[model samples]
Each structure stands twice: as structure tokens, then as C-alpha cells.
Target: MSLTHLDARGAAHMVDVADKPESRREASASGYIRMRPATLALLAEEGLPKGDVLATARIAGIQAAKRTHELIPLCHALALSKVSVDFELDSVTSCVRVTANCRLNGRTGVEMEALTAVSVACLTLYDMCKAVDKDMQIGDIHLDSKRGGVSGDYNRADTYTEQPTPIVAASAEAGRVPLALEGERTPSVRVKCLAELRERFGVSELSVPFHELASANVAGLKLALKNQYERFIDIDDQRLLCAVNQSMANDDTPLTHDDEVAFFPPVTGG
Candidate 1:
């Protein structure tokens, strides 16, 4: 199928949604912030330097949904009717589960808005609590369901796992950013970055949701994390540089179980 964002000459252009019928659209998304038990307690006791972590994160999520067009290119801006952000504390796993819902009467679905809300909320939580736990993780940001569109409705019945395996392809997973960091986020093999990629992605780590790495090399891992975890719809994998262990490894480099691979984009300086 032809890409909607491209013109006849392969130039970028926004698709006109003006002709589409307006409907009451709503979308729901969710993710988690995993931190140390101590950090969770800190927030619980209202001991963090930040006044209220959940309140701050809730406001940030709602604001982000409103400004989704600004952060995401080619996304049509819509007047959102409602945005709801909620957090549930799970002390057993030391995870704060964030769920966001966005609604609007518009030509397009509110999936992006909902996803953006969850993302910013998790990030805001990390930012406020990072002072005590720099290793906090933001993970599994995915659309739970969406309503009112030509495509009909979608809901993710299977989420998380007793095995903690990554959710593979299903249409509902579109645009979900799985930027998970360490601290028991998943049971499957993980992909992490080194100094440079960590600094660029603004997180020291993230993981792809693949059951087995198989013969896939380092480049494959980059694509999984960027396309799946980072949720950058327009990411070009070729622009990324990878390294294994403490040495630089090319995309052709073979991968193995429990191997540490680092990735970053090429730098150009004057």
C-alpha cells in the first residue's frame, strides 16, 4: 500500500482528513513505571522532593495529549473533548501502572493522543522520582482500545505475562512505545544501550519484545527497540550505530543469549 504521508514524488505531505466524517472517537492506552521498592515507598509517604508525583504526572499527561500534534509530525491536531489519566500502584512489583483515555469528536482516532498521554505521564513520573531512583523504567506503552472509526473497535485482552514475555505483533499494538529499562521489567532476553545511545534516547536502557533473538544480529535488535520500544514511527534503522560488549560491533555482528549490545546514531561535529 502507498504511504499516506508521501506524495507522488516521495515528498512528505499530510493526508487530508477533512473529507472523513466526524465521529465521537475515544482511545485508551497504558504503561508502567518500575522502580525500587524504596522509591515506591518514598512516593507513598510523600517524601519525594516533588510535592505530588502522581498529580504532576496526571497534569503532564493531559497537557501532552493536547499537544500531541506538536511532538509528532504529520499528526493532525484535533480539539480533544476529554483526556483522563490515572495511576494504580502495585507494590508487589514496585510498578506504577498508568492508564490514559482521550476522547474527541473528530475525523481521526485519538490513539496518538492516548499513547502520548501515557508516555509523558510515565516520563514525568521517572523525572520526579529519578532523584532517588535513577534506574526507573518506563515500559509497555500500548493502546488498550479505541472506538469510533472506519476500522471499528480494538481491545488488547492479553497484556503483561506470568512469563513477562514481550507482546508480539497484533494490530492493537500499533504505535506502542516499549521503552523499558532494567529492574525486572521482562523475563525474555533484553537489549540495552551503552553511553552514547543511552544519552540520546534519554534512558540508560530499553528492551525489545522478542521471545528469541535467533540468528538476528545487532541491527535487528536496534530495529526492535527503536520501532517497538521507542515508538518512533519514522525511525530509519540505518542511521543507528551499534556495539557489543565494550567494543564496537557492526550490524553484521552475531548475537547470543545474555549479550549486552549498545546502540547510538552517528555523530557529526564541525
Candidate 2:
């Protein structure tokens, strides 16, 4: 038996907020829809065939917040003070993030209202663009924060907000990170950077530090790069190119003093 349902057979009783005094309440929720990169580019630069996607999604979210109680069996029909839905385009991830905020002065919190708003907003975007993009995936629905509740204020400490859009496009064979040999006995190495790495670390034909030559293993090099560009990189992305004198190498590759090495994002081509 579900606790949230009001069926007579259910074991739980309705939670009453009658004794509680009205307080200002606010809740925020977020979700995402991922699609092909080209489709995302179109959404950002040009309007869709079905009219403006942002306008429709925003209206749908507002309407969904008002009808939360009807959609959810146990939710209280909130007398919402305000409901705002916004979106941001993340080109690298090929995702559109939908954020919803619900505010009210009521006995019950409006978390459900906010969640419903985000959910429907994402759905509306998928529906309006389904004709052009069939591979759309909706995920990452989560409650970001809540306030004015018995449980106290809560916030998600970690949230991904895409920053510093990738500047360098796909690189051909000629691209390489800045490299220089300083010490007399040091081995010469060519370091190449591609895609996001190039822009994030700003390493383009630049001179290499004396201690940062071709001595460490591939794993160690990755660690060093991560430490140098931690803020701009996603640590989980360990898939980088390890080439020894133009041949593909792995983490086990022993970098010598005279090898050409490069780091690159996964190649994508149609």
C-alpha cells in the first residue's frame, strides 16, 4: 500500500498541516534533455518548425505547477505566488537544462509544484522537437534546493553549470600543444591539445616548463594535466590520446625524452 495515495484501503492517513502556521515557501527543481549536437545548434541559432520552443515550454511548466495536485495524488493544490521556468543551452553536452522555481505562502511546501514544472517543461521541449530529433533523452531530474520547511533549508552542494564553452573545434593532424626543451640532457617532446583541452589550458605551441619533459608515464602525465587544469576539466573524462612519435599509445606507454605526445577528445564524425 502506498502512503501517498488517499485510497480507503491504504494504511497511512493524510498528513494535515492544519496546526502549522502559513509560511513563505519556495522550491527549485531542474532537469535536462540531451539530443544530437546539430539539433542543439539549430535550437540555439534558429527557430524550430513548431514555433518558439522556449515560449511553449515555459508556459507548459507554469501550467503544470498549477495542476500539480491533479497529476500527483497526494499533492496539495498550491496557491502559488510565482512560478518561473528558465532554460540554458549546454552545447558540449548537447543538453538543454530546465529550471523551475515555485513560491507560495502556505502551510504545505511547494516542492511537488516545482518538480512538476521542470518535468513538464522538459517533456514539452522533447515533444515539440521530436519530429526533428528522435534520439532525445530526458534525464537528470533533481531537486536543487528548498526553503521554508520543517526540515530546514537545503541546497545541492554540487551542480553542473556548463561554463566557458569549448572554443577550438576538431583538430587535424597538425595541431599540437606548445612544447619547448630547456635542459641540455632533457628529451625533446611534442605535446598536442585538442578540442576543450586547447581552450581550457591555453597550451598552443608554448614553451614547456623545465621539469615537465618526456619523463613521466602516460598515467602520470594525465595526473599532471588534471592538476594543472582541474577547474576547467571533468576528471571522469580520462579518454585522451597518448601517442609516441605519431603511434597510438596507452596508459602503460613510457614517455621518453624525444617523443611526440598529444591529448585529444574522442573523435566524432558523420
Worst lDDT run of 10 residues, candidate 2, spans 1-10
Residue pairs of candidate 2 with colliding backbone atoms:
177-192, 178-205, 178-206, 187-257, 188-257
- lDDT digits (tens) for residues 142-224 of candidate 1: 88999998888887774333234333222223455343433444434345433344444555444553443333776566555
Error of 2 at 35 (Å): 0.8
What's the residue-level lDDT of 250 in candidate 1? Answer: 86
The C-alpha lDDT values of all candidates are 0.73, 0.69
What is candidate 2's CA lDDT for residue 205?
32
Question: What would the per-residue lDDT of candidate 2 be over residues 50-91, giving only the tens digit for each residue?
Answer: 878888999999999999989976567779999999999998
The TM-score leader among the candidates is: 1
Q: Candidate 2: misplaced stretches above 4 Å?
A: 1-10, 158-270
Off by over 4 Å in 1: 158-214, 217-270
lDDT of 1 at 84: 97
